[model samples]
Target: MNTFLFSLKVMGIGLIGIFSVTVVLIIAMVILTRLFPVSAEKQDEESK
Candidate 1:
């Protein structure tokens, strides 16, 4: 029972770390996209 509880605690901590990193990455992506807006003309040219 003690080992099981320890494993659960580790898993919970790992999940929280992963979630925090994911949130940071999403925010960074949003900021970057706003700084460098994409042009429709560029997209059309690339689709050729």
Candidate 2:
């Protein structure tokens, strides 16, 4: 039982770390995109 509980704690910590890193990366990407957004004209030219 003790070992199981410890394993659960470790798993939970890993999950939290993964979730936090993912959230941070998503936020960073959003900020970066906002700071340097693509123009509609550029997209239209690329589509041609």
Q: What is the C-alpha RMSD of each candidate to the true structure, in Å?
A: 4.1, 3.8
Q: Which ranges of candidate 1 are over 4 A from the true structure?
A: 40-48
Q: Give the residue spans of candidate 2 off by over 4 A.
A: 40-48
User: Distance (Å) between predicted and true CA of 43, model 2?
Assistant: 12
Candidate 1 structure quality by residue, lDDT tens digits, 1-48: 999999999999999999999999999999988876688557878999
Q: Candidate 1, overall lDDT?
A: 0.92
Alpha carbon RMSD to native, model 2: 3.8
- Find the 10 residues in a row with the least total lDDT in model 1: 35-44
Best candidate per TM-score, number? 1
User: What Cα-based lDDT does every candidate model obtain?
Assistant: 0.92, 0.92
For each candidate in turn, the TM-score is: 0.70, 0.67
